[model samples]
Target: MRRPFEQLPRSLSPLPGEDLHGFVLRLAHRLDLTPIVLLRHTGLIDPHRHSAPARRMFMLEKDELAAFCTTTGMSPQDAQALTFKPHVDSYPPVATALLGLRGLSPAPRGVFPVWLLTTSTRYCPSCLAGDGSAIQQRHGGPWKVVWRLAATFACPEHRSFLHTTCPACGLPAQRIRGRSRSLMVEPHTDPLHPSRCRNVTDPEQGPCGARLDSAHLTDNDNPSDDLLNLQHRLLRARPYGTSSALDSLAGHNRMTDLFVLAALIRATWPLTADLAPSPSLARALDHDIGRPGPAPSLRISATAQKRWDSDVFSARGTAALLAISARILNLPLPELRLELRRVIAAMPPLDDAAWGQTWLNLRRDSSPLFRHEVLQLLDQRFPRPLPTHVALPGFLLIRRRSYSPKAIPQFLPEEWAEIITAPLGHTSGRSPGKTAIRRGLAAHLIQAVTGMSLDDAGTYLGIPPAWMAAWGRFRPLEERLHGCRADLSVLFQRLTDHVADQRAVDYAARRKRFANWTLPESDLQRIVENYPGRRRLLARGSQRGARMRVGFSALVWSQLTGSEWRLAPDLQPLPVEGVAMVDAGVIHQLQGRNPDHQPFYTYLHDLLPDYASTVLEGEDHQ
Candidate 1:
């Protein structure tokens, strides 16, 4: 028979904003018992680890906590709500694993959130160092769940930001007390006391037991109380409601969307700021920057790029970035919403590829919401109006939206005749096949304006030749293709505008992959001598001559060889399209197969058609 556990003589009342895991530890300490002993008594011990010597008091599961609460006469609801459950909606995966949500939910398999949290816990030092009187009265200040948020910079009560890494050892704050049998240190005996750095960096030496409190705070970059209040509200807010439908479509929940928004704001900033025209946002960013002098050129460092690209961010950085995004939305700094309607409204058409590149950078591995938001913004900016003069506007608009061209009312061959040819006063009695006229006009326009074949122009516009054939299917072709008949000036203006827009999109996609690459001095010299414009300096040092980037070099080579080279991968063993792994013996055998004994390049070309002409050093194919 299982022995029945009894309630404690003195059970600690739940403190305000206290996490249940910490509360349980405090309870165990007050009971003069080890966490394992307390858990065993409460019938919550893991059978697998029950007999195992000692273990850290990591987070507890829902069932275990419920059992603990039942045994200790504490309300299970209070225990759960006080723990990490409050933020589960924002960071579902961490909470799901922490709480073992699969055991709680009916259909838990596909319910993971798109974003993740930092792999460490954070806490406010000042909040932990309460007065002794307060400690004796109700234990101590609680570990507020608000501090767990990546966007939470400061503790309103402390007027200082939460600390994560220890100052002494630079190790992350240890939330789960290390020892199972006893408290790690004397100061930490009181659960609410500020954590001391107990990180053991050297086995021979004792822990760097420095107290983690605001008394030793060095930075003065605390956000104002108003900002902190706004952050508090934003962090606590959940993504439940009608707006979540948009989140569902975009494959992101509310919290992940906020992260994407912050990233986009940081990436675009001043350039996109002009589109929204928010004085409040400008003022907030300026205040945070605290630069009285003329704002220096905004050249982002490589370190900053890596930080921005990563999903994780310091609370201070996240808060500042979110503030700017809030300003762009024209919402009060305190007001928060999960939907992107206002944000999309503020976004200007992504006219430049750099803007598109910024969107791509922020939305990488992100939910569909980011891409949908961009497309919707473009649609709002340039609605595909019935082509008044030429198909160029229609094509550009359709291409920008990235929706099916068939969905829109396409221009007919007669419409093209009206725009391309001078106004014929009398209607012609004879009309040719609609498809033929449409194809001829499309071919003529593409060749004349872009100076490329029909196929190449289609590729540039992200449309297939087969897809273009279906365009204007309802109309008939009557006349042979000829030179454009529209006003010369109008044609030139339309062509330039269309081409410029297309180029911006293309450039942005290309630049997104471009990076600073280092090459050997010999390769650098060859590139500079052969293609001066292609060489770009990335870094330079005394011992090593200036290292040049190979992004443009790779792009030039791709164009020359008619074979694509992917620039996204590491430069060391670069990623190519058609290269295959072959043994040295295979190469020897293949070389021997040539009856006339042709060069190795010839045999390699026979194996991979595009490889022989470009990769090998020989007569240029072009």
Candidate 2:
């Protein structure tokens, strides 16, 4: 067991908005001891444990926090303020869950995605030179927690881009390498100033020890006023403020939206070159993101592409990319959609497969509103009719609450047919095989409204998977009814409108009620009593009778519920020939083509409603 920590004789109060790592550095400096020594005394690190500390140390656990607070005599709330946990709701990048870094020991080594900046932070030289207060004069000023975010590019107070790398070492300030876990480069070194560069230049020699606060800015380091304003807007949106200004701009997800837009701007570089604010900013972006040919993947190697992605978060040339991204994000939805369309149209001609892959990637990374707009642009660019055999992409589906699959039938309902035809105008005297087209239309509607896949919708409607696979042969006929894109859109909208306006039936209840239902034996016998031959055909115990019983049950099921007869309970086991015979018999009786069978049809029509009411009664009780 480790010894308990005693209150320190001298400890500095944490500065406002200071980060946990920076506070540790300043506290160690105030007591004239090394950071590692202070951590050991506070029981934060075990000397016997040779392994390096984990990155999670920055976000201390309960017991670890208690020990640190006890030794420093700082309140828990004040210590917690030095960490990033409070800002997670307003700032997205620091949310460890989003970065896939939550609960990780030492964070993995690699080029992380542009959304997170974990390894290092950019700094404003003037801020590090102390605030002229007594405590800051003894130990350097606070290293702000906000500086670690990739979205924070410019220093609003200084009116310039934050410095990317140290002047002497040419490495990022306060960088934590893959194998190293300590926040400071030289954690064991005593008497080093908090604002000096501690990066290890050589193993044998000590750190670079260059004074960071002494670095000066050049003319080019200053950015335009517009870029500064953008930075200010972002700062106002941070959690430190009483109210987020960005909430009014893009709602709750404004930071995430901005990050996604910046990523897209970086990916599609000079293709969006015209959107750049100034000539100097354009050159900076060009240096960071090289000018590629028509397709970015074709010109850039995989390694170089990874580096470019990393640079989007780095201080090197990020201002230009973010400036362009902010402008695009500020546009109204209509103008934003048009601008995106123009950018996509400017790309060099590529095959359909390549374009599809690009769209897939965009859909994967985009926000919901952004994804919807991109899909609309795609629909305009490629007006191919919806395919019947394959699943529709998610973007094409209606909202889930709009319709239910159980409410749709195998054939288009008569009421829906009337609504759809109104928008189609005259058919030019061409039949176009309305029955087959109607069935196809029914399948399409199930998928479009309920968000089911083509196969799932077909199965639900009593269409076999094998039959759907062979639907390609009828594509030509389906195309005739589709007419032009405008007609198709109008027809679909009308159908959707009708569905939304009407009260939905309890089809799920009907399905549950009829799942194991069969017509009573007494009712079946009474209908067949008129003709002895027909009665014998449906007699009990015969193989043919068993099939005929299922068929009769299916016929009655179709009468009670308007669903397809083929989906009737206990009917799937019958052979194809038996099913065909049963179907033909049912059709003959219902059509009243045979005068002799007219009485039997009348009896069935009268009996079904009574049986349906009984089933509904049971459902009500349940």
Candidate 3:
């Protein structure tokens, strides 16, 4: 590690160009190496600033090469490998060459086709140290001088070209640590967190079950410096075990933006705050920021902060920020993992506009959709856009979002408590929205299907019966639904046992209330009673239909040809969703009207895919 990098001769055999500058540039094209790596071994194409137009042309050419590789299914690493051949035999010479331009031979031969990797450093024009000098000067010496090379750029002769010192190590002209790689690589967030392992007891450390990374620091005014190193990173702050989203929202704007990504990992994710926890962060806040932890936790007269829970420092931002926080917070595995998961979940589901830009940026290769579970999620979120729907139900069936409120606790530090208040409610509670009315209607609809008293379904879905009844009358759609009776035993058991098809039975049960199926309390008692083969009723077509069904559903529509069908519980019909639950006595009535129509299938055909209703629990044991 102490050896000069100049001795590291670049092998250009399989690559396309030759000559020092040309070879380094070609090696850059071939190896996709960073300029600092290149400069350590060689030097700049122009020792001085070339015309801006000339530099633009060079950049344009580089951009074109990248585009070509991306369009052809080549990753940055693949491109490097396709053109690189790391030299095992000529290693010493390359190492010497990497020690900087001073150690090279003028009559260099054989080195033309040498194996080489490249990296680059930028220098501050003022004092030749680096643009970081002014920032480093403020932090003083301890963090300023990191690399010996960064110091050399400001050595007397070149001092005038440098600006300020380094922020981390404070040395003039020193390069900050850039990633070291061979051939080519994609600079992704490291994916080696220990939490991903199968250890049963969660680790006491960070989410990855190990120490977290350091957060990168940026000058509030110079956003350009932050973006300068991104080199093809995805914009979406995706978490580990997942790909990223390169959206414009993540673009550098000097905003010091804070985000909280909460994943309901394992059992529950505690509610964490979204501000930096350090006293330094508090010291950094503007006067208007109040308590300086999070905007929501401010102790101003706002009632929300008193009962608030949530940790300070949102879990996202530049790799630098994430790295820094990971290092500083020393978060335990559970907390870190939850934070990572939240980041994953909080990431807006990628849309065509956002994902497309990334695909295009990547040269339109496969469009990053190969991940199976993701492809399915794509279908669920945009059934029409992804061009596939059958796979979606399975995807959504795997992760239902409802968990207890336990996650709220996990978010805040143990010392903090949650402050909850009715967001806009006042003491008088006057002027309510139509939301209440719609909710009432939804309640009334449920009672029709489960044959629950207004009180029963209220208990399940968590609304009171009186409010539910009033809401029902308020919303017209929930007022007119009914279903034929279902034996209560069969409901808690298998729908197929009492009804013809399980899908139809479940569908009927779910919809009875919405359809306004009259369920006298007697229906519940009937199924609760001894098995009655046929407790006769007045009969169909009587003033009060005898064999009345009960259930509420929005699953009926007439096609141009007049065909109709029942919808699966997901509200869409998959072959797995094909079950028939018909009025045991009335199957004969609709026979000729629809051929493939099992009374169950009849309602199902019209079913819409309600992706939120299910999760794949790995095949029903039932």
lDDT of each: 0.41, 0.59, 0.25
lDDT score for candidate 3 against the true structure: 0.25
TM per candidate comes to 0.42, 0.55, 0.19
Give the lDDT ranking, best first. Answer: 2, 1, 3
lDDT of 3 at 73: 34
Q: Candidate 3, residues 1-622: lDDT per residue as tens digits? A: 2222232333333222111222233344334554334433332222242211111111113442354243333344433333212211112222222211111111222221111212112222222112354422221111111111111112222222222322333321111122221211111112222111111122343222221112122443132222322211211222122224332212211011111111111012122223333323223321222334322112121232311112122111222232233222234645644444443354343432212122111111111212222234334544443211111100010011122211111011111110101211212221233335334322333433333444554554444344455444323221211121111111211211212221222322233322332234353234324223334343434432322222212221111101112321222332342333443223223322445555443332322232112211211222
lDDT tens digits by residue: candidate 2, 291-320: 332111121223333322233433536777
Q: Tens-digit lDDT track for model 1 on 1-622?
A: 5555666777777667775444555566577665556556665564333421111222335556656676777786676565455454444333433433112221212122212322244677766554455543344455555554445666776676666667777765542233232212222232333344545676467566676654367554466665666565455542222233332223223444455565455444454444322354355443534433211111111222222222333445445566555444343323433334555455444443223223332232233334455445545655652122221212111111221212111122344444433341324332334434434444334433333444554454333355456543212221211222222223323433443334222222322223332234465444335432444342445222221123323433333332232322223344243222322223333335435544432333243334233433342232
Candidate 1 residue spans exceeding 4 A from truth: 1-6, 32-44, 47-62, 89-118, 131-139, 175-194, 204-207, 218-221, 238-256, 265-313, 331-372, 377-622
- RMSD value for candidate 3: 24.7
- Candidate 2 ranges with C-alpha deviation above 4 Å: 49-54, 96-113, 178-182, 237-252, 290-316, 346-367, 378-622
Whichever of 1 and 2 has more TM-score, that candidate is 2
* Best-performing candidate as measured by TM-score: 2
Question: Which 10-residue span in candidate 3 carries the lowest summed lDDT?
Answer: 391-400
